[model samples]
Target: MSIKMMPYLILDGNGAEAVAFYVKALGAEVMALQTFGGMPQSPDQPVPDEAKDRVANAQLSIGGAEFMLSDNYPGMAYQLGDQVSVCIITNSKEDSEALFNALADEGTIHMAFQETFWSPGYGIVTDKFGVNFQISTEA
Candidate 1:
């Protein structure tokens, strides 16, 4: 048996934009993008028109690693700086720094990318969409 974990981000109505930004910043590939309107709905539980275009789910791959994301459920409350953070282990220092800087463009940097005790480079940032990230070079 094998076990794997994939982090799922729930953006506050900005999931699609976040996915697009990640594609450019982290060089991630969009595996799938499904909107709420595309999902099958029951007549008794119709989806609201305002949410029809919101992201229901999206799958993205960065290098060989993958993760999923979606817009927050209709009335669910979401707060930034939560306990979860997506960590990326890069192949080289340049890759790690580049990704860290890209994510810091309009985001808050909790830690700047630099030589760390455990790795050649490491940093943490919370992207514009409020998703936290930890970028590091392989140890």
Candidate 2:
């Protein structure tokens, strides 16, 4: 199974600005972008007008490496040093599980391995070295 690792950055609310900056500063290409307002929502979960412009997800490729960015949901607090995570994408479920378990040892499990809308198995963990990781099988 092929595995790819990429850095994911959480921008408090400046994802659009960040994407624009990266495009000019690093010659990055914006691969995809989705806004919070673009997603389907129930009536009870209406999106606020202010958040309509917030980026729900954005992908950029810089120097042949891909990175993801997203604006934090409204009311979500973000701080420096905690805004970055390594995203591990694997093609095999077994590989994803193995990696998740190995990293969970002596580490904190921020999210347990489980099926998610985006992947067959996904989870988050902070390794022994304090590096945050998001492990998942390819969607």
Q: How many clashes would you count in candidate 1?
A: 0
lDDT of 2 by residue, 31-114 (tens): 999999887775987998888899987999988889998898887667788899999999988899999999999999988999
Clashing pairs in 1: none
Give the 10-residue window scoring lowest on summed lDDT in candidate 2: 72-81
> What does candidate 1's lDDT look like per residue over 67-137, in tens digits?
87888668765777463568777778888888889999999997889886557988979899888887878
RMSD (CA, Å), candidate 2 to true, equals 2.2
Q: What is the lDDT of residue 21 in candidate 2?
A: 98
Candidate 2: stretches off by over 4 Å: 40-51
Report the Cα lDDT for candidate 1.
0.81
Instruction: Please give the range of 10 consecutive residues that has the lowest summed lDDT in model 1.
Output: 1-10
* Residue ranges of candidate 1 with Cα displaced over 4 Å: 83-139
